[model samples]
Target: MTKRPPALVAIVIYKTFSALLLVVMAIALGLTVKKHQLLVDFSESYALEGKLQIIKWTLKEILNLNPKTLQFTSMAVGLYAIVTAIEGIGLWYQKAWAKILVLVLVGISIPPEIFELIRRMSLLKLAVFLVNLAVFWYLLRHSLSTRDDNQLQ
Candidate 1:
């Protein structure tokens, strides 16, 4: 059997990381739902502010069983993660659809990356932005080159 190329390997790793992050987020959400007081105590202890307040407010709604916003958000996150994982698996198998899916995802992420750079101008954030740009460029170039190869064959 032929070994996968480096680009494919990179996508597999990215997908695995996304899947793991989703699982961790899901578990944390569950814990927050089950033990609201735990979250409350932690927040109170830390004297959290700003974005922390926003997260706390969101969690409060979830804890109170206000299903609309929380349910929608959870569903969206779950679907996105699952779709991304599927695309990753497909890319590992060198499927054309996966290449398109990845490009689309990368496109969608650009705005948020820009927003992050504007919000926090730090070396760490710049490094992250540059890394993402590199990943996006590498994947795009690989996908296009592969497509060209197929056309010439």
Candidate 2:
């Protein structure tokens, strides 16, 4: 097997990490369903005393979410996590379809990212947009180069 390019490896790692985080988030959201009081108690115990008011306010807002909404969010996040995992695995194996999949998904997300940035500019949002843009560019260039190489062969 040919050695994988470093950029591709980096992208795979990013995807894997993202997938793991999403999975954790999905599980946490799922578990939060019908557990408002438990979450409140836990937050109260663990949260800093000085920041109790803020913590309480945040907890209250979260606890107010509908159970069904949490369930649906969990399922959506879990599904996206699965897809991300698949993308990582496929990319690690240098699958063409994986490149295309990532390209399409990233391309689709750029608009919403731009909208968010326009709505409220923040360092974090800017950083995410830049990173995603870099990834998209690299993948597109790599994909085209790979296609050319295949054609020549």
Candidate 3:
């Protein structure tokens, strides 16, 4: 077993979350397929008569009994999952291209996140910006160091 790279940790974590998203999307797709059978009975089977009933409400909202939208959403999530899995595996192996790929993705997201913060400041937005900043900086430094090492050889 090889030791994990410190800088790749965040990317790995993100990719892992995307993998979980893939699972959730798959479930949603299945429920959409069986919407008529399962969703109609959602309240009967999963509802509660309490404050946490919000959870049930949310479940119903997400499982909105719309198979078409769910199918489209699931396909998008599946594509994201495939990309994330590749990035995750590549980063795990410390591949140069993975670092570049992550750099580009995170770089592109930064401006949008910044724009979002400008629109509405929140802890979540701040955290996302900071994490992306750190990853971008780490990859930049790593690339420079690797380049220097190559030149010295």
Candidate 4:
């Protein structure tokens, strides 16, 4: 007889994959910040005597900010990414709360998914939406099954 994979194993696999991706994204973002800083340093050096407005615009574009607002936005984005990556890693460990958290988190994303579907209609993004839907479906089914089993016992 062939054996089927356990539901928890599926959850772990999904969570771990997402966690790793988030980690890689976080690292990439960190590298971007470093590169932006290097650009700012170079601009401040010999380029100060050149076209000031163009340099200012270039730096603002690189850092994704205006002159008045500081680069705190980039830091906020990096921190958010790190926090979510940690949450994904936690879910991979099959903590009970993490399961519920993931469910709620994915649930919250559905509205934005709908907006994206309406606006751009990108297939790759649609595929990601579908995958997230499948994950939530599986989690709901698993939770219901567990509840039913407990009631029967």
- RMSD in order of candidates: 5.0, 2.6, 3.4, 6.3
Best by lDDT: 2
Model 1, CA-based lDDT: 0.73
* Candidate 4 segments exceeding 4 Å error: 1-7, 37-94
Pairs of colliding residues, candidate 1: none
Write one digit per residue (lDDT tens) for candidate 4, span 1-153.
Answer: 434247555666666676666556556555656576676677667666656687678665766644223335445555655655655666556555766777887788888998999999988889879878887887777667777998999
How do the residues 36-149 of candidate 3 rate in per-residue lDDT, one tens digit apiece? 456657656734556486777776776664767777777777777777788788888889898888788888889999999999999988987997798889888988899899
Q: Which digits, one per residue and each the tens of the lDDT, describe model 2 over residues 1-153?
A: 889889888889999999999999999888888686688677668555667587678777777787788899999999999999999999999888999999999999999999999999999999889988988999999999888999999
State which candidate, 2 or 3, has the greater lDDT: 2
C-alpha positional error of residue 35 in candidate 1 after TM-score superposition, expressed in Å: 2.9
- Which window of ten consecutive residues has the lowest lDDT sum in model 2? 43-52
What C-alpha lDDT do the candidate models reach, one value each? Answer: 0.73, 0.89, 0.78, 0.67
On the 0 to 100 scale, the lDDT of residue 60 in model 1 is: 61
Where model 3 places Cα greater than 4 Å from the true spot, the runs are: 1-4, 40-53, 56-60, 63-66
> Which has the greatest TM-score?
2
List residue ranges in candidate 2 displaced over 4 A: 40-54
Model 1 TM-score? 0.71
Q: 1 or 3: which has the higher lDDT? A: 3
Compared with the true structure, what per-residue lDDT tens digits does model 1 show for residues 1-153? 568888678768877787778766666565555566676676566455555667778756666764354445566677777887897788788787887887788778878988988987889778756766776787799878877998999
Ranking by TM-score: 2, 3, 1, 4
